[model samples]
Target: MTVPEKRLHEDGDGDGDGSGANDTTALEEKRQNTQPYIKGIAGIKPEFLAPISSLSSTYTEYNDDEAEGGDRDKNGSQNGNGDKRRKKERGQNQKRDLKQKRDTVRLCVSLIDPEDESTPCVAGDEEKCKYSHNLEEYLASKPKDIDGMCPVFEALGYCPTGMKCRWLHSHFNKETKKLIKDLGKLETEKDKSFEVNLIDRESKIALQRKKYKYEISEQVIKYLDSKVQRNDSHQENRKENEATYVEQPFKIAEKKKIDLRGAKIVSPLTTVGNLPFRRLMKTLGADVTYSEMALSVPLIQGHQPEWALPKAHISEHPGFGVQIASSKHWAAAKAAEVIYRTTQHVSELNLNCGCPIDLLYKSGQGSALLDQTPRLLRIVKAMNGSSGDIPVTIKIRTGVKENKNTAAHLVDRVLNETQVAAITLHGRSRQQRYTKEADWDYIEEVGKVVKNWNEKREEDKEGRDTNPTWFVGNGDVYTYEDWYNGVAREGVDSVMVARGALIKPWLFEEVEAQQYLDKSSSERLSMLDKFAKFAIEHWGSDEYGVNSARRFMCEFLSFTHRYIPVGIMERLPPKLNERSPKFVGRNEMETLLSSSDYKDWIKITEMFLGKAGEDFQFVPKHKSNAYENTENR
Candidate 1:
């Protein structure tokens, strides 16, 4: 199914009234265009396309100006001093909050002697404590009308926040006058092992102490450092004798082969590709999933945030990969070794060389590595050697700039110099961002190169030990048709989905079923409910947990709202670049779900999470530049 080149309204069908005959005509055209293009699926009924009131009261587009109006009024040009004071007060408040949190975590009651004055109270001194030591007082302070218990305490048997938890009334026993600590309950709960998969605190300490052995990785790092220290002319001579200097490839009698042919793979999205989302994607029929890109330096330095990236749901195993970005051989080698030592779950260790974020690019870690072919090769080779049994892979773009495509050369080099198991080539240059369509022709050409390389290698008896690298094409794959057509291209084994999956995570389900599924508004809400459940399970169901879930839900909605319902589209298989024209849905709930307004997203979250506090506010990750460019338009 193909998208129409022009929208109905854009084709000069408007009657200047902005309401009346022209509007009715456009709605009819939209209805006619809603016929299912796929062969098997039943076409949308006319009733499904019947227009509601043009002016939707249930939905309103969120205006950033309106949201920030109060702030503007208080901190406008006339209140420069007040703005500065407010900023200073905010900073002070943040510091105080951090200190208080630390104190709360550090507080511990002496289990041996609760009455000892010398022993610090985990609940602090009873006289000055913010929390009630008596269960009766805690119960009295809580609302008499409140419903339900603390989900975290109910699931884990113990609350990590202790007295500070907002649901303190839930776990405290009035009859026994004691707090129940049943932490072992988590052991039996299904899919609640996210924390168990992370690198342990002791392991991190060992890493920092330089006590954990990484013999092979250390050796590779030393060799690469020496190579870097050599004079430019000597380095050139070393390149001429590259075979002599290169480390001998490690070999086993047999290695596990990775086959991603026709696999539904999700790309490593930065902030949006958290564990809950990957788990959701797995349930939705995605064959492969990757963690968000982590920086190698932070991983080597034992940073908690970086280490968290590699944690995966047990269900994602046998197909989950942890992707890392690095500019240096040592960082890449060491990080891979750490991952190898820490977990048995990773299917592959992938190097990310296609990230285009300015900070990453400027740090010489991401797409900037494209300009330094020698360094890039060294990092990939080092990671391949250090990552034990897991296969090494790399993701790259066409190139860093427009008009010049360098991926073919890089792919050829990797195939010859390193034993990488796969290469994913995003068919657009870094500079292109999302401005233009991905260059599929160039991707097809690169696929041919890989195909020829594999054919030639197959004919050579000695090269059989070196794994046949799979070629995966990425970009603009949104539907079953796109997935099928992409893999059908010569040498392409599979496709990697990014924004497409974010916009419609059930995309893999569609690919598996080989048909368009026009999901009902209720069905879509059910998907959101699943995500919320996952989030609450992973992040806990405490006050902070609920807020974090809400924030991430909004982030997910930012993309989900872009899904123009197939039953309302002016054409079959809507293009990713096509923006929706304002139109109401058949029902108020559907219209609310369709709204792009951040306010509406928050409202939707409230349906599952209860009312948000007044302090709750959210801004999308990608700011709309439409307002800034309006003058030009």
Candidate 2:
């Protein structure tokens, strides 16, 4: 038996066209040397042959840079057939990847159905008639207003008629309404504040595809099918078949040390790092999560509430690192000591020096530390020295202002001055604030520099088993290929995901499985419910706690909607920039995000912060597209 030979074959028709490229084949043939090549030695898997052999040569059929008359004469254009076929091939690969990615892990929500009498907790705080009766009896038995001092639950506001903290209930309720009214006003005004493009029903899929294209960018080829569209009848059947998909989760719990000496994480990207939310991320495959950056004074003061900022569930034990900001070394040391001594569960203590907001900066801390490296160094050294057994970390930016690129130098200083566990460098300068493309090339350069420095140190001191400090790359790693390139580019130990992780908790799910998940709205909402439970469980379930949870959930809804596969109620993965069928509740959040009006996003934010949102503004540390939309901030 003779085995056929294989190569990338193509049809070279006249006029440099892709015509008659019906099906060029890649026949697997055997090779021979001094010894004859055995039959079946090439070993192309039979099952994958159909897809592999279907593609003609992948050589660019347009450019003539290589050969005269080899390039197209028509306005730098490619033969339409080849372009279309290439697009189709790309789409097929993406679909296959999505399947693999979504198959990694599935998150489960714990919302109790109000109608389930057999259960104790009812729809998260709401009670059935029997429970309501019991609650009334319990409250009646308690002495009303015993201490005259409102309880933390009540002072922050949770008591009253019907067990509702009327203030918080009203606050959460009104914030939602105000957000809608503001959005309505924006619609009437039209493109004044920002062009609100709600991801709508008709264009949800188109928008999702567009977002995928933008996110993947140069990482992977997107094969789109047009001329030979899927068989609608067969497509529906196939869709139904694909709907029963689940992700196999990989639980990584080994105690690996982290390094954050010269790193930079957006200070307090809270919603995702909090309980339930962080757990969701872990289930989705996140490697690290910083506790919402805590305030140093409160933390060291032994304020019981400040511990809340640094608290973590056992699930987040090894991966959870507490981040805190301080202007003084003593305060930083005190906070680090308290956290290390108090929470036997936390893995590392992170020093946050990357925040750019005015309040924190003006108060002599946060990104302001960028302006004072010596002070920052002192704080880092203090934590590194004082944090016993526990590792110490730091997050830093490229520099204080735009012109000064201090990060590479800072990494050098940190290496020289402190023994940190890991570093996360947000590629943007303090001034840039998530406005532009990250300087990944510079980050790679810094990683190489760190590696070289480590080598030199080892050479200088023999027999000293100096562990390699982990260097995590941050900024704009949105897809599997992006992650693949970022992690493998140089000595980058891992990647710290902030917004991308928040937008799609399952993003790490893709990186681990080497694919993407086409999550539905119901699925995304379920994750939100888990986050809410985690928040309530962590923050407490009193009126204040519940209202705060609802409020933040609304804030999260802004980013979350961006990840919800559109057409959730009826379809899946809504149009990228189109509005949803309507903006109503959580179901409508995706549409609001699709619109890209920061006001709508901010309006949703007001749901937690309360009515006079116009008076205060939140500038996201890593605001994507903020360069073009700086006016919004």
Candidate 3:
């Protein structure tokens, strides 16, 4: 299915009224031009497409002129595809490179003067301490404490950042010069609100020191090497020794089972898929969530940022999966083993073979693995052998290039060669990216093959593993109709929502209701408000924390601003790629919510995260200067 180009509505407000709307001939032409390719399976009602003003009694009325024009880029003329792309690229400042770390005075935790009087500073030798122990000097150099109570301390009962926290005045007593704490609340909320999968100091030290054991990984590698050498022998000898060749040291059934049939999964979006966002997805009814892809080399080197990817909220358990990308078996096995040993919250260890970024692809990771099936198989086998009681899964695309699809052939090889618990097939090839529509037909074709393999496994269960491997379909699932349709497809066990969920987080809620929900702008704002609160809880409410939350919030807003309200659409079901013409919303707030300007996103964040300081700036990863009317060109 292809996305139809949007036709410019000269004077119509899209409410099926006014001069353009009254032209029944023009309306018919528009409908015929932009008809949906995939028919709705969930019995989509025609009334659902009615304007918001007619559907909702509480909707604020506005002038037709107010709905005519929005914030359209002057340079964005819809002359051609090149011009449209240029207009879209105008929303982003591609060269806005901001320094990650700020120049600020920070004090060590040991010299912070503990809230508990009985506790002594860990740094006994004051002069030998690496960090500044001169509390008075450090305090004088520190910027004034930010106003307002620290949301982290208020919610989580304690501030892990302590004296270094930018909102230090909230918990500090001026006269006594002592930090304050809610000791009772701290004890109760210790394990509840805190994030899981934190590697212990000892474990980190051992890994860095090269003292961490890799017995299981070493054994697995040794076995794989022996098999490679044995392949040089005669066919009869190889067949005779097949029984003695152990693929894995343990059984696949012993690992935690992943049941994804008819489940709603949130894709592990890079940068945007943080702990707070996943937590928000859980509230919206996501059945499964994955951590952002971690680099195996960094993970093996005990990198904190890579390790942070595995940290999940308490609510994510039994469904949270940690994903890692690697090109080699040693790196993959060691990374998987470390994560399995350190984290009890992980349901499955997923190998990311679908990332199409040039950096990862050039490094022989991500989509590069698709071309090297043997290496990919070895990596999966090694992960299974090393990762105790943790199910291994893989996410792949149709192929590395357009026209030439290999996922079906690769699926057969993967099912026969490895003990993967689940396989997620993204319907787009690496070459396709977002330039074209996802090939769901190809996804279903692969899913059917997996189904056949699983059925055969069920029929002959002796000696071979009997567990049925699940097949999940990913790409371009935007609405409840799209979700239900994908799941109803032959052999597709579930669907993974990515950009769709980012744009409308309540998508899962809609899927559960099995209908279109024309949520008010206020309702959508409330969801963003909840996200801000969750972000503060996870990242803290101090200056650094607030900035972190604000930055990510802006990242979220970058995608969310694309949601053209269902009520304003001329058709029944909205396509994910359909670019709407600049049109006003039911209210002023709604208009702001649908803005493509990055500045408007900042204004939205200011409502929840307080004013972004002069030091703060946000540059969207993608440009979004929506098309302007041709007359303006």
Candidate 4:
């Protein structure tokens, strides 16, 4: 398979005139200086083979100089200028703003439902209502209907967004002036409950008014206060007699046990792991999924935005886990109690002790818990005592710094101190971040320790309530080989995938097949289309919803665009650390899919959602093209 030559930009702006002719003699001269060849092996689908005329608008031209060591310095800053480039933001954006203002006005909530027209203002009289109830005025100033069928209405038999839907024309009766619904389909499809973990209006109001009771959490906290010594150093060992004497306020109920021996689990990702993405993963073949890590403080305070993190699709149940981060025992206890009381779909409640972001670590949460083992154990104990039958799990890293691995040493303490159901080790220190490869050898050692501890408990004939903790390893499991190798180890039960799943959602499918399947460009596009539809269904079909879906879709593409196709690789399996050399695809669509430019990502989103507004803009969280010096921090 011959590879195409890298196309050069004719101008400095990185946008060149559309041209196809190649100078063979000049290409041959430049071939010796280029990197290894990578070609597109799969055949292109006819429907996705776009015309060259459209390519100019859809594709961002790569600058020839930038691809071949241009004027930029090693720090990715421009040269020959006294002005220095602004350093890119790292970790979480403290000023992250997602408030999307719509270009046009919207109708009042009271007027949205055609069936409930009698109660124009349920909160009060219609004259006192603050929202605009003028339907005629709203329709007149509403943005033009988007050009496609409403994906939510098409699948669910009805659109919940009602008249506010951008695709209003698709399911609206202009003559009757009523939103349409497929009664027959609704009756046939029995389960209308698509999502779970939603706090009711009364519960939310109660929380806001500080009227909701935390009876279980209060009891647990009071008991802990009576027994635990404040200001005690974590290094000081507790007296052996103290362990047998101190009892919890009440006996912990028998919880549902989870066995992750061979399960393929998706890690609790932050921004990208939303409900729509998890639903897409479930369809692809993931056995387990986790919600984005919710902060315990906000959850206990009844903040609606934080509450949205725990909402899960119906298909995710029986394997779904809700993860929460807290620095204090009270917050963890109260949050766990509330989640247990309100949610029926959760299989486990996971405490996050592995998040390495500066914002979390500085706040005495996440990896900071590694240093404060006493506080961490107290938080875990409080959660276990409060969250009735739901299993409790925790995700931790090696330690806080390099060359000081503490996870193996902390294993015995965790086993003896808390009744956690499972332990997931991420195999990297908080300081290590992604600078170096994950230390799986250390993870295996920790796994062995956990396995031995469980065996010793079994041999000692511990009480029936004493459950054996499952050990799962995470980090850098990108392929089927990685999955098999991890599971085949002596003590590791399963693997939890993060960036790998984001790059290839069909990773579980490959694990089942036990071989690499070279996906075509068209197939990948189809996957994106499915995600788009799911996002629309989950977010809504309004202008704001469409843009929200588009923003997230772009985020998904940011990670996926790094995937180097199996067919093109000179080697068998790709390494997470290795970078791909500059290469063009056999076809234009395939080339477009491989683009790292955010502009190109926006162009891809436009393929599903209509053309973005002039004001629509996206700045990726990380600079994918920035050079990394592995030797340094």
TM-scores for all candidates: the values are 0.76, 0.52, 0.79, 0.83
Off by over 4 Å in 2: 1-256, 259-268, 460-463, 564-633
Q: Who wins the lDDT comparison?
A: 4
By TM-score, how accurate is candidate 1? 0.76
Assess candidate 3 and give its TM-score to the true structure.
Answer: 0.79
Question: Going through the candidates in order, what is the number of backbone clashes in each?
Answer: 3, 46, 0, 0
Please report, in order, the local distance difference test score of every candidate based on alpha carbons: 0.68, 0.48, 0.73, 0.74
Error in Å for residue 371 of model 3: 1.9
The per-prediction CA RMSD against the true structure, in angstroms, equals 9.2, 25.1, 9.1, 9.5
Clashing pairs in 3: none
Q: Which residues of candidate 4, in runs, are more than 4 Å off?
A: 1-96, 122-128, 190-193, 231-246, 463-465, 623-633
Residue 57's lDDT within candidate 2 is 29
The worst-scoring run of ten residues by lDDT in candidate 2 lies at: 95-104
Ranking by lDDT: 4, 3, 1, 2
Per-residue alpha-carbon lDDT of candidate 2 for residues 477-523, written as tens digits (9 for 90 to 100): 55555566677657676667666665566777666676556665556
**Distance (Å) between predicted and true CA of 630, model 3?**
23
lDDT of 1 by residue, 1-633 (tens): 222233223222111223334444544454566522322121234454424554232122221111111111222221112356633422211111111011222223442122345756556667776543553344344322114555556656665544434456677665665566764675666355454358878889877776767866877776665556467668766665554557643432233578898788998886678888888898899889898788898888887877888988887888889999998898899898889888888898889888765556667887788888888989987887788888888999899988899999988987887678899998878776554567788898999989999998999999765788899999878777778878878889899998889888899888878778888889999988778767766765545566777877876777787676777654455555443445557678887786666677887887666676655555543223111221210
Query: Could you say which candidate leads in TM-score?
Result: 4
